[model samples]
Target: MNITEKILARASGRQRVSPDDVVFANVDKVMVHDVSGPGVIKVFDKLKKQGINVDKLWDPTKVWVAEDHFVPSADKVSAENIVKLSNFTKNYGIEKHFKYGMGQYGICHTLSHEEALVLPGEVYVGGDSHTNTTGALGSFACGLGHTDVAYVLLNGKIWFKVPQTLYFKLNGKLPDHVMAKDFILKIIGDITTEGGAYKAMQFGGSGINEMSVESRLTLCNMTTEAGAKNGIVEPDQKVVDYLSSRGATNISLIKGDDDAEYEKIYEYEGSEMEPLIAKPFSPENISIVREAPSVELNKSYIGSCTGAKYEDLVAAAKILKGRTVKIRTEILPASISIYKRAMEDGLLKIFLDAGVTVGPPTCGACCGAHMGVLAKDEICISTTNRNFPGRMGHVDSQTYLSSPLVAAASAVTGKITDPRDLK
Candidate 1:
């Protein structure tokens, strides 16, 4: 079995496992956001009426909460939802709730790594589809629906049908102008949105080893766009170093067997990779940055768990530094911690000097509601994972998803522009 299988087998207390094997794996960590928290509460309400024990979580210490989407109390409904989540966490004694307007809150997926909330060889589950993002830490992380999450909260375990692993090998290091986002976009294009459904997508090879931990997280984060069950990379020294910096010390790495099996193996030459973008309406509708459609872009959004990491902000700052954006641009860090780091490193100043709005670390803007959203007929080049119609605002508005460099470059030109093409 591959790394994914190995982790699942261990978490399930099995000596060995394979694709399609059903097992109830004990969960090490679980998360819920404001939206899902409320949904889970509703599930609990139903469960309570059904005479199931819904009065307490299996382990409050193992449960965490994040207030990302619908944050800043987007509307009256959102405000009420946050209140419900706060009460739920308090009642359950879950101390890891990262609330908005509080000291260290941001997107849930971003928090998974920044706060060292999840570790390698664990079975972590969250209520958001991007829960797979934490697999970068070598955990068997995946997302679950509201009822499924409520079940995990009460039972401390959930059943999963083992997913076949798809191994993506990067043969060489990515060029300075390229990013993990480009590579993932290229993969989504090749596999299409439905290709990885119910499958584990594991990244490896020389290029992945050469990439930074945050870059590897970006690669795994977008695996959801390919409809994958999870995305993971083998834990390494970099993973340990990263978690240590975040104050996590009890780090144990996990790796697959020498002859680990995979459902299929795909290889790519990272040196030959270039910046790529996914056009509106589908993550699989991709094109190289230089080959993107010529159109007036109304906005350049560089924020989201997928693209608003510290390194991503630095990459955007490098492009926006002395170059004023030709169109409106927004830079929202993925978390307050990253926001502070960006400010401390002078990245925020560069963005402001470049005439971009540096906003709070909120997913509202990236998810396309209650923040700066696109107007009808407007087109945006964003550093986000998905680009479905109305993903950002008006149902008629269009979005093109790209790496931070490409988005910042296109912001300067008011058109789809590659970072390498910038003067």
Candidate 2:
């Protein structure tokens, strides 16, 4: 058994569990943002009509809320949903609500790490697909739909059929020009979007260990595009320090056993990895950034749970310093903490000097909800994870997904260009 099995086995209070074993594991933490919060409320309302005891939760302190999607409300309906979500949380006695315009608000997944809300060795679930992002902390983190989240809220438990694991071994440190985003894009391209369906994608090896916790978070965040049940990296010293710096206590690092079993093992040489991109319509449609076809890009977005971390901003700023963008560019830090760090570190100045717009932290436009969505026929190079049609705006709009470095470089050229090809 591997780390995943061990976690689930212990969670279910069993001596041993294997793949396909269904167990109602006690949940450690659960979350719902403004979008899913409202959906969960609707489920609660429906349950009330069914005469269930929807008045109380199993554990209010274990439940947290985020106001990310459609925040800085785009329309009357969105505004109303935010209000409804607020009331629901207040009524439920949930205390960790990160609201928009509040000092610490940000994307839900970003908050999961920046605030150390989800600790290692815990089973954490959220109402967004990208909730898998928290798995980088070595937790059995995954996403649940509205009804599923509501169940966890009331019962403090949810059943899952243990998933088979796929191990990705990254050897050595990646080149400075390459990033975890590029490595993940390459893996998704090789496996295709449905390749990891219903399986856990676990990363390991020297390269993964060498990567920063934020970089590992980037890797896990994009695993949703590969149709993975979840993505994870065994927690280590880096994970401990990251969480501790954010004020997390009782941190524990969990690792797979030396005899851990995996369905398949894929290996990659870090030096061979290059800047990669996923063209529009699907995340599996990938290509080397330098070999990309010529296309007129109307915008470049350096925001989202996938890319707007502080390290990502540093990468983009490194490219944009003393240079201006040829296309409209926007940089939204994943959280207010990241935003403040960029400001203090002068990364914000570099972006502003490069003529980029720095907006407040939100999941804006990443899910095509609001704030700088694309127009018809508009093309964009973004640091986001997905590239499906209409993902960032009009149904006809196209998106190219890349690392922050590639996106920043393309912003300076108005087309797909590698960071090394710039200047």
Q: What is the TM-score of each candidate against the true structure?
A: 0.99, 0.99
After superposing candidate 2, which stretches have Cα over 4 Å from the reference? Answer: none
**Compared with the true structure, what per-residue lDDT tens digits does model 1 show for residues 68-114?**
99888889999999989889999999999998787999999999999
RMSD of each: 0.7, 0.7
- In order, what lDDT does every prediction score? 0.93, 0.93
Per-residue lDDT of 295 in model 2: 97
Candidate 2 clashes between residue pairs 3 or more apart in a chain or in different chains: none
Off by over 4 Å in 1: none
